[model samples]
Target chain A: MQPGISKKRRAYILLMRILMWLSVALTAGLVLFLVTYVMAKGLPEISWNLLTTKPSYLSGNIGILPDILNTVYIIIAALIFVIPLGAGAAVYLNEYARNKKLVAVIEYAAETLSGIPSIIYGLVGMLFFCSFLDMQTSLLAGALTLVIMNLPTVLRTTQESLKTVPQSYREGAFGLGAGKWRVIRTVVLPGCVDGIITGCILSVGRILGESAALLFTAGFAHAVHGFFEGLNSAGATLTVALYVYAKEQGEFGVAFAIAAILMVLTLLIQLAAMLVGRYFKKRRDL
Target chain B: MCLPMKKRQSKIDPVTGGSDIRPPVLWDSLMKKQAFENFIYGVFLLLGLITVGCVLLITVYLIISGIPAIREIGLFKFLFGKTWASTAKTPQFGILPFILTSIYGTAGAIALGVPIGFLTAVYLAKAAPPKVKAVVSAAVSVLAGIPSVVYGLVGMLVLVPGIRSIFHVPDGASLLAAIVVLAVMILPSIVNVSITALEAVPQEYEDASLALGATPTETYFRVSVPAARSGIAAAVVLGVGRAIGEAMAVMMVSGNVANMPSLFQSVRFLTTAVASEMSYSSGLQRQALFSIALVLYLFILLINAALNFFLKRSKEA
Candidate 1:
């Protein structure tokens, strides 16, 4: 307590400190409430039947197996297309580009792409992939739209890891008569494997959570199909299914079940990201 | 073997050495290798340009599709018109309600979210012990990772009902509920970015404040916060962008009706307006939806530019 300080100022500071602690407590409490509430409401409804079979109108049964498979298919498809383009862009920007202005423009474009809303992506995706390209609201069009949306995420992560590769390593490889591309393939590419993996996990989490960007691009169909077949046909992932069930069909039970599954997956992704970060840190130290 | 062959070749060259008179086969092979490397470099360059191409494509598509409706509706009526009756006989295309709802919704979310987020960020970054910080931060990340639709679901189940019961409103899906959901939705970005900014404040500034007889809280608020103003501004701006752009969660809770925004009344946001009607809309109505999206896109672009400006200033400072 300073001799010159007033009691009112002391009260003000006390109030702020209390409010800060309260806000932090509120945040933690909200998270706990959401997870527990969704799981408690949803877990009992999830069954082997729900996990394995598609919905049938004749039986009046509702299942999310198709949605789950659709999610997996879209994730796989988007990652397949996104990784090469994203990592290649990152490599070029970090390793090959000499012009500062061009690099800045590319980076700015990536930033702009990321900031655009998912609904906007859905619209443009609907126009370009569905109408113009005549893909017509298939999972493939949805996945392609996500390719553009997640490109910045993958590019950023790969660029960060590429930056961590030592210049000395590149010099050593070149000293051994390796060409530039050979040096990149042997040294730089290997070093960024963790980043690419991390990016994949992050993008998967995003794809799992996405709904607005998929609704128009991937129409809501419940049929389960093979990978190529699914890509060419209309389908709904879990998020979209959740929206459809809760908002359109009034099936809170099915929506809650999907929400619970997504919550668990979200937790897993967060944990994996933390572990991967730690592993990379420890490796760098060693 | 390569050294002996090179030596033999050099001796046989008699008048000129290998450097002056390389074999045509070797020269051709080297030229091909150089060309191949150049081709690979060109491939990578093209890959980099793909991102730029995507941006161009999005911009061009939005503008081309977005212009016709504006041209037909007249920019004034489309932008400032109060009614949004798209399906009625002699349909009206006013989007003032949507625009105002978005503004109010985003403002309301920011008002509610920023204070709590800023305070929580201060506690986490400066006051909390490492273990507590880790746990709380993890909790925040989980909150963030939960999808927007999940937020909408939870809001529909809990917050919507809760508001209905508490306020005795006929339908709890109103601008207030949307604001509440958006506030919670933007919390993670606000907290995470603010924590980074607050932590980046130089330690000596706080230490000096403490040495000058200021309390820790006082030092943080008076000294640390002022130093991190630009970053905090950026965080707020990021929250604004998120709250405005959010569609699914808002659509789920906001009752999806075009109305002049009153806190307790059902209203449509700019995002929900575009999303709700895009599926069934036809002809000029569909074009109007594109025009709505164009407006939203422009808003986002402006926000992005502001974010970049703040981020750059923070880095320089």
Candidate 2:
């Protein structure tokens, strides 16, 4: 449309613009359709019975309480192990590392771990944790596998936050005769709480959505138990249960109900991450 | 001078507790504290190396558990075999079908997904209004966050049936269905990463292009996109990794048949081949499943190296 533009150039520009608009429309339309379709078909199937009890063949009743409990147990166990390890690695890299080669190697390893697929993780977890360690196919074994999967997330977030902490703070602590351990424990660790919390939310979302990694390590059983008992016994989380109910059993109703629950949880986790990130960013600015 | 020295001495006294603490006691406590610090430092160093240890463990275990079956089956047959009937009497364990299906499926997804994702990223980064960009970006994140199983469920219910009716195929669950689902599943990553890359292009370059009488769209495509080409390449490679590694979503729609991967035929990918039979397999079948996983890992390693190369280039640029 510009005065100097030729007919061919104008046609090319017009075609590119149309393509751009069409792509945006298609992408946005797909998201809208998926959310509405899942919600409409899924919300009606959720009920009090589905949330409170276990599935029983005698009465042909289906429930998700056990799966919910198993999911919670795995999340708790994985977090307990991953937090300390991930945070410690971040601290060591930022505050204590003197060898550049070691730092590069550690970073590369983290990247490689993230790139490996969940199915491979499942295979290795089955071989190493369930068989080699003799943990059996239980929630604990699944949780241990997830700890490795999520370590890179926690490390990267904590490292980013660590970089934002001022160097003057560390110098002041040392000036007061504090040792390296004391300085990190008192000054550096506290500053990275927001990052750790954000990482946790993201990891929880990934764990909730995971199925391939859990299928082999955590066998599917619809029994309910206490925390320690649950870790010892094999169980299925919500995602795995959805897969089994839909693919093998052809139980579409139960699968949809579970999908709806996961959708809501994913949205909530995203919102919480955004809020935590904004709150910390504002505080840091001040 | 006497007065200043007296004041300084008083100040030092208050801090040192009037010199009651002898040099040996102070030195001894400092040494203990130093040792304790070293101990804590060592603990952190151990933690840092755990990631390295994990990577080594996965590699070693995959090779150890994944090789016996290959050695037994012959490496050529294992890699290039055309059949995968692990449960059949006198099982045939060639994985050529799986290898081809995975490659074809990933290529299909990339072919369908990248152009759309790239155009959307260009629009978002260069042309869209702030409100539209924010809304679309949030939608994209939601797409990313949705569980892959939900995508599978939707595809199974809607896409498979729709494809069956429209295409008049006997079985709707085929390689085509898997490719469609995967294209949708990979859209978010391509769009999000490309948007980041496009946004990183220096504004001065665009301004110069515009000043030289190029249109805004021309400037974006000609000037900005070239500057961020490496990042965009990295994004496409990342999408390839996701498409190849995906198991459950593809499993639900692809019919899980070990065919040679025609668009309209049921086929099995490497990831699904391991997952579908792991529950009931034993002996050579189980070890062969591990071998399949090892092959998938090699594919991922190659993709990771490519991703790192592009990412490093982008950083330097």
Candidate 3:
């Protein structure tokens, strides 16, 4: 640290710093390398027929149509059941609640829930939503489980974002003699649109990537005729499909295809979220 | 978005600027205000009640479903027993090996994960130029976003085969693969938390350390690691919890074996066993699989509670 320090001492210090950071860099690199290699090796054998067709273990036709159908159904069911509920919860937390202590507790609980492993949610799903509710291995069960799982993260995130709507904007509306509901509808909600979308996209990404909880509660379905009518449906997500294919022999190629799909979906979600965030920032500037 | 800088003057403020303020519709305004307050209170109350109900419903169901299985297996054997198989008549539920695998797997992941994660965070925070920080942080989140299943597949293709070739193992899947992949999977969490923790250490700590003749590198390790231990520990706990509960990826590479973890041998964790066989399982077996999940749930709840406690205490300190 001293200006008068010996050159040898300085050299030794530099060496120590380099070594410390180098080890860390090497580890990260190795991890990334591992992931990238597996993906590349597995990518070659994928074909469109594999996805459009249905899986036939006996016939050797490795199709993913059912898995795709199930994934779509899960998303739709989640949207139908959870969007209104989550939005309602956020509205109450953001606009109605006055007790700071209660607010803090909710916030803390929600944050904890967000950090929890998805598999725990799966366990809870199988128990409460699937068995206790008599909605076993059905789309209803999976959707309900997702509602609970996605609630804390989404509601808290939405509440936080909604709360960020400028108080002055609401006051301005009020000063103009607008009703409370009208002010909230016209100003506060719009202001929080970008933030809510951010939360939605983040949660969506989590949902797409989620496998652990979905495995048991959703059950595995190869195919479905319709998305809406399949209430007592069992299905697999792309992530789950990848898990299924990766484990068994001869389906290694199919596994990589699923992984690629998941990765691309994730990237698209991230890109959209970034775009939304950037748009908000740009709009605010205007 | 911005909060109200100042509370707006309500209609009841009778004397603004010392002028006589008269409101003929005072009762109407007051009633409206009261109603609005009531509505908000009602909503928050409902939400609070629902949140608690959600927590209770899950916890209670886990207990209800798992207890019968535990009673049948006998609680001691369910927790400490090594043989975990279930049938109609004689259901053997031994969770000891899974417990060891989870604990040991998590420990190994931490050992491999923390150092690398902490260093990358340091590099990203301190050494990496500011312009690069933005892209790097996003990349880290991308790492976080990558599904564990994908990581498992990645392990299968890359880690598994690489280990086989490098170490001359019989097959690709092994404990070695889990250790490597889980460590990597948890790296971003570690780095993100560590950077935050390290950044939180007051600038004065560095200045004071420098004044005492310690270089930045020396100060970073000697002083920074201790100061940021709480946050770092929180990160580690989160990472370990993640590793312990991780199923799909671990299941893929773990060979799904229940034996003790040799460096090259693959092992199924409690989560893996549950997830692996849940599709075909029924009756006591299904219940037992859920019981494994229940055990993990309890661990998560406990770990989270402990984490919140530590974070609170750290903030207070």
Candidate 4:
């Protein structure tokens, strides 16, 4: 609007804004671009044999079936512990407690817990939880360790969702002479179903993608048979596999294939969570 | 029959707008009421105890189990040493160089990520059309949900080679490449927190600022930012915590070498140092790795403490 605010100055301001946004877009693009380029280069090396077969000493062209199996096993096992434990904790925090001091402490604990570096969790997983349980890098120990790593996140998300339910609904239920348990089950739980699902989906992303705690407790095994045996066994995950392949794989082709697999898996997870969440929300609306 | 009826009548009368009543002997007993109340109270106490117990046990566990390596390495040398060869004859555990590398890398990332994240958050919160805001926010969240390992994979493939060619570096996996990737990795946390903070600024403040002859942008920088400074500060610290604590993505493209960080050179960070050598390490060397991990954890803890302190100060102010 001013006379001195000429074309050059306006142009400079516009350019700066564009550059600022370009960086954000570029930052987000870095991973996708990398994965696409490498996977395109190396997908040929990936085969059914590479996926289904076990590792071999003689050649670099081995399979990751066991590692993949281990990753799934630990994640499922982790969810088992995380869901019940974390959801229960969230329930307690949201439904029962009335004291502000107690609530503050729980909130502080969550922030601090999330801040602790994962490597320390790995060490503790190795030292106490795994050793004491006699689980030794087995799915049981890995799951237990990850349960600790994930509980805070799971609890926080669940608690936020649970809190979103209307208090009036709760009061109405109570006025009907329903017991406390019945009120929570019939009114509160049903109302927050979507939020809970969102939390669980987000948490699954964490458990599947995590590497540090698994580093010590879920020592890589590549067996896909007999659920217990495979679970108890140690091997690799998509993450650990990518790490191992990138560092130790003699051929760039193999390494790139593994990296591509990780990228696709992660993108699928993000997409699935969003789509599933939206689908459920749309259904509820209808 | 007559006595039972009379007792029931008395109990009902006392509870429902009746005179103080006497119940029959068995019905009037105090034991049942005490037991029920005690059980209810006990359940509440147990839940409280569990929360307290968990926080206490984990903190104590981290400190007790994670300190031995620090003890062995000695403070100055472990923190300030340059060599990080876990398999070497002497097995030097000087993680100082790695620590500094982490610092610089984290610094670079925060510098690039925070501003854009803040502005984008503000746009999403205050400026953008609602539909566009929703899409952008979801995109940001998707970026957040994408695993760190996946980010690492991308860096290794696209960013590395792209940087190598663009900057004319020998390797694509250099400090600059790592910085760009990490900046992306941190965007979600920064944006999400900052948006919440910006949205928290009361609308009336903006209206009032506009009445004083300030432009929208001026009001935003001076009024909104300062008013939400505490939240922004908390957001920044939280990002730092994530950046420093992050391991998988940094390890993938940081070139995992223990040396001073040159902008174009490959460097290892404290996180990458532990992760790369962890699978093969043993003895004092492994302990030293644990020490480095402890240092990383300590840095994060310090950030958290600072966040709480700043939040308190801001609240008081």
Off by over 4 Å in 1: A1-5, B1-20
Model 2, span B1-317: residue lDDT tens: 11112356456542355667657776677657655776887899899999999999999999999999999999999999998888888899999999999999999999999999999999999999999998999899999999889999999999999999999999899999999999999999999889989999988999999999999989989999999999999999999999999999999999999999899999999999999999999999999999999999999999999999999999898
Task: Write model 3 residue lDDT over B1-317, tens digit each, in one string.
Answer: 11221233343342243357555487467557656644645654676556656777777777877788888778898898877656536667798888888888889999998887887777776667786677667777778888888887777766788999999989868887888888988888888988887788888888899899878777777777788888878888878878887888888788887776677887878788777777788887887887887788788888788777767655654
TM-scores of chain A, one for each prediction: 0.98, 0.98, 0.89, 0.88
**CAPRI verdict on model 4?**
acceptable
| Order of candidate numbers by lDDT, starting with the best | 1, 2, 3, 4
Clash-forming residue pairs, model 2? none
Inter-residue clash pairs, candidate 1: none
Could you tell me how far off, in angstroms, the CA of residue A155 lies in candidate 3 after the best superposition?
A: 2.5
Residue pairs in candidate 3 whose N, alpha carbon or C atoms collide under 3 angstroms: A66-A222, A221-A235
Candidate whose DockQ is highest: 1
Candidate 1 CAPRI assessment class: medium
Q: For residues A87-165, what per-residue lDDT tens digits would candidate 1 score against the true structure? A: 9999999988878999999999999998999999999999999999999989999999999999999999999999999
lDDT of 2 by residue, A1-286 (tens): 6797998889989999999999999999999999889989999999999999999999999999999999999999999999999989999899888789999999999999999999999999999999999999999999999999999999999999999999999999988977788788999999899878888998999999999999999999999999999999999999999999999999999999999999999889888888899999999999
Q: Is candidate 2 or candidate 3 better by TM-score?
A: 2
Q: Tell me the lDDT of model 2 at A79.
A: 96
Number of clashes in every candidate structure?
Answer: 0, 0, 2, 11
Q: Lowest summed lDDT over 10 consecutive residues: which window, candidate 3 chain A?
A: A27-36
Q: What TM-score would you give candidate 1 relative to the actual structure?
A: 0.96
Against the native chain B, what TM-score does each candidate's chain B reach? 0.93, 0.93, 0.86, 0.85
Candidate 4 structure quality by residue, lDDT tens digits, A18-40? 65466546544653555556568
lDDT of each: 0.93, 0.93, 0.75, 0.72
DockQ of the candidate models in sequence: 0.60, 0.56, 0.42, 0.33
